[model samples]
Target: MTIDTLDIAASPMPATVPKRSFLQEVIEDTPGSDPRFEMCIQCGTCGGSCPSGPDMEYSPRRIFAMIKADMREEVLKSNTFWYCVSCYYCMARCPQQVHITDLMYTLKRKAVREGYCRKSTASDAPDFSEFFADAVLKYGRSFELGLATRYHLRHHPLGAIKMATGMGLEMMRKGRMDLTPRRIKNVDQLQAILSKAEEIARQEREQGGVA
Candidate 1:
């Protein structure tokens, strides 16, 4: 499907100030280190299949090219990183086995590290992944509506108020939003699992020595 182009000319470019090179810090020299980027054949298959492409300041194709050129600041500051819906359409369809979703995630981490993220506000906020992780860290499983409400309140205070005053009340009236979070039995076990996984990841990073 062909998507109409947005006004990319009006989009904000990265600041002229010099910044540290996160590219050298996060990516490794090994194969598949940036597999999605390296393997991309400029097929535009990823961009063609992406549902969120229209809303993005740059397509997945352009973003990968920017990364290949080590244009870290320009790529990170683009709206594409924040707009990815994680639908995995690009990943599922890539003939080169490029993990587009993972690449986007890596970009997001770099953006956050550089403090180039959007602030939590009524309309705009950071990604919901952090909120989801926090909920999972607190409880074993996610409570759908509870998580949503908590995220809204924590990030978008005004949005939360409006949500509560309107949609929240409606949902509560319909018994759709649960007030209490359902705890998984033996929550400590899950906590231990999560902690172990995190430790393993850290060890892998240290050993791999990939930035």
Candidate 2:
């Protein structure tokens, strides 16, 4: 659906509605707070660079337009956020110096907040995104295999059993996966940083409600 299909007006600042665009908040929340959207010259450079553009419901260019139009709900609910592979092609090719990858990540954070995420199935582990976030929050580093196993156990108990049966013997033989997580020496410091960052983001989100 196009941004015009929505009842929202196409304006940077919506005077009638006390609403915040998801795009605007994303731009604001990113580290260094790059004005990625501000520099778009409508050259379609980002769209050309995006490998997944053809499959997307809205191209990167369209998303930018929608964001500028303050179509917050549409942007958040769309599958466009999940489709980004973080390739950074758009970021690298952008003539305007827009941090496209960072914007994609911001949209992902919004997707999580809006409960737009897909649940794990019987054969699948929990969302790797959640596990990744947890790892960052807890250890300030990613423990990929550990997080994957934990995610599987937490979200797909049956799958975990199957996985263990299938790979447990091999893992034991090779000593590839560890049951216990290796702790970082300065975990508290890492947690503190993550906690503060999360708090700031939460505040920004609260301030910038759906438009």
Candidate 3:
């Protein structure tokens, strides 16, 4: 009846859950196409090829490094994505074809949503983008006048008056500006599609999964 029990220290430990890095989180949260952020090789090509490189707080590769290090707050607070002109030059030049531009766009949306964009000098870009998106959701098309009016008035009241009087009048006179937004045909259908897309995005964000 001599039964010896195995030592607890020698026994297998329970499986420990591994924490995900910011890079993995970004890849998971990226919708539509798979993000190749993990493919980044620390090359300086992306940084050198950016047209607005000088304006950014961090180069794309450096940002990728930060993401790898799980520096979510630092990455989101950076003006790097805002300065990305979306010219695609960096993506074009990268030997890895790492979806640089798309990643930048994703970061932009994430930063704005998380309220990290307010401390940025380029924060107005997010506000204007929101106004433009609201107009599209409302009319199934952009209302340039309304968008500009709302954005400028909120950011620069004096400049808004000047812009309304100056270039705004000229554009209206030239028939390039309209008093109202023209609704696209089958606008309800468009809205439904857009709403569905939004629903998918929300689900992806919440689940931290890719589309």
Candidate 4:
């Protein structure tokens, strides 16, 4: 008898199985997600438009299916979530209007919160996001020089020096990039609004609403 190595029966089962569906759990946890999460038509449009899809462990469409299949750990740990560049091509091309980019961002945040973010290039996105957010919170505007300096110094010091010598100097000379972050005159009011927004978000999360 000839063996069919590709047969599902030949595969080993996991020791433990999840008690709940991953997709359902996520929907319940994140009410802010597009209501069309379950409406994907398995089309390849989103993946085709994604510039980073070729480098991802799972394409956008495949990740949606994996979510439906309750592959929680695998999906969260995958580099696909972190690889999204927020170019919006996937979301714009999705026939189902699934907000693919938003879902990808949600996944990235969740992965980081759950301690699943990889300590490699896959982590650069979240690290940069943090620096950008901090810069905004502190100065009411993104300080590109500060963000770049912090990111590259922490990640690639040698490459940072080379970049600083090249594009950084050009930007400085053009007066496009500021060495010091400028605070908005009404920054205190902005901070108050931000604090209130955070409070509302916390309340919503506690109430099982969208985060």
Candidate 5:
């Protein structure tokens, strides 16, 4: 499928500012990453497939175009990644197998790492993602109760107590909550793996000349 192109040079922007692009970053970090960005036909399949597309500032198709256009600030500030539900419908429906969902995840990581998430109204999403990652790295699995308590205490103290009071006992009675976290038997090995992954990522960023 062929996609029509627009001349970005005609867009209203200062000529002195060099255009920035992160398509390579997306391909490097996204799971099931693919570099065949040109395969996108602008058919709206991914946008239509997304359940939360309507709530996003830019749909997946438009985000792809922005990426190609090197609209880094706009794309990074967009709520597109936060709105993704990981349903995989977009990826499943894409004729080009573009891995749209994974790309969204990658964009979310980039937004957080580069501090773009601080300017977004959807800061909670990145905060939750970071909290979840920390939890997994520490416990090998999400410690639900601990995570909830920690998150609320840091982000919403008043609401935290209220929410816990309302549902905590009920959840415990139903055996839905555990006060203690269960640690995996091979936690040390998992930590080693994570450390190695981080080391590799640090090396890649250095090699790519990106801070």
Candidate 6:
């Protein structure tokens, strides 16, 4: 992991401008969040603090090392960032105060935009997130039955049918899974808030303050 001894290789991602290193690209990609990826010391602290580290294709610490190595293909296609639960334990415990959680978000965006998420083992993460977000925006509350039905149908049609006939029916019988979604009391207010946030984000992107 020593910079002097490490062998540098061409990144799978396209080079740009004066040619930015993968590390610099990551830092730039997460603008405003200020992910201090360069400050990583290979202490293994982030990996140790991560609850999902064991399930990741690469641990957080290793992902950092790979990032510095300019292993764009490997890093972006990894399950490390996708499996992150955003619990913030890793970020809080890092001596360098690397924004581990925020960095994961940055990486997730890169993975999705670059089409790497589709090639990843944790590819379902994005689909699940999209379903959840859609539910929230439409109903102002999570519709578990709809979420499960849609997710299962898209990923596992057979499982979806089985669930609808079996576990799903039981959940509905017990009132755990409602057949319909419920709107919040003030849906317009929520929409206004979300719209304002999106507007600010759009402005930030125009200013190169967000990527």
Candidate 5 segments whose C-alpha is farther than 4 A from its true place: 1-20, 33-35, 209-211
| Global lDDT of each candidate | 0.73, 0.71, 0.86, 0.82, 0.82, 0.87
lDDT digits (tens) for residues 84-151 of candidate 6:
99999998899999988888988998898789999999988888888988899887999898899889
TM-score per candidate, in order?
0.72, 0.68, 0.85, 0.81, 0.83, 0.77
Which model is ahead, 5 or 6, in terms of TM-score? 5
* Winner by lDDT: 6
Off by over 4 Å in 3: 1-16, 207-211
Summing lDDT over every window of 10 consecutive residues in candidate 3, give the lowest-scoring window.
1-10
TM-score leaderboard ranking:
3, 5, 4, 6, 1, 2
lDDT, candidate 5, 43-73, per-residue tens: 8999988899999999999999888777888
The alpha-carbon RMSD values of the candidates against the true structure, listed in the order shown, are: 11.8, 7.3, 5.0, 7.3, 7.2, 6.6
Pairs that collide, model 4: none
Q: Which pairs, if any, clash in model 3?
A: none
CA displacement after TM-score superposition, residue 104 of candidate 6 (Å): 1.4
Off by over 4 Å in 6: 1-21, 28-34
Q: What's the CA RMSD of model 1 in angstroms?
A: 11.8
As for model 3, its CA RMSD to the true structure in angstroms is 5.0
Error of 2 at 107 (Å): 0.8
The candidate with the higher lDDT, 2 or 3, is: 3
lDDT of 1 by residue, 58-113 (tens): 89988877877788777777878678889999989989988788778777776765
Across residues 37-150, which tens digit of lDDT does each residue of candidate 3 receive?
Answer: 889999989999988988889999899999888888889988899888889898888898899888988788778878999877777878888999999998888999999999
lDDT by residue (tens digit), candidate 2, 1-211:
9966876666567577664455556676676655567778778898888887876778888888888887876776666657778898988889888887787777766666665544311112126777877877776677766776778888778988888788865786688876666678999988888779778867865775431
Q: For model 1, what is the error of residue 48's alpha carbon versus the real structure, in angstroms, after optimal superposition? A: 2.8
The list of candidate 2 runs beyond 4 A from truth reads: 1-23, 118-126, 150-176, 200-211
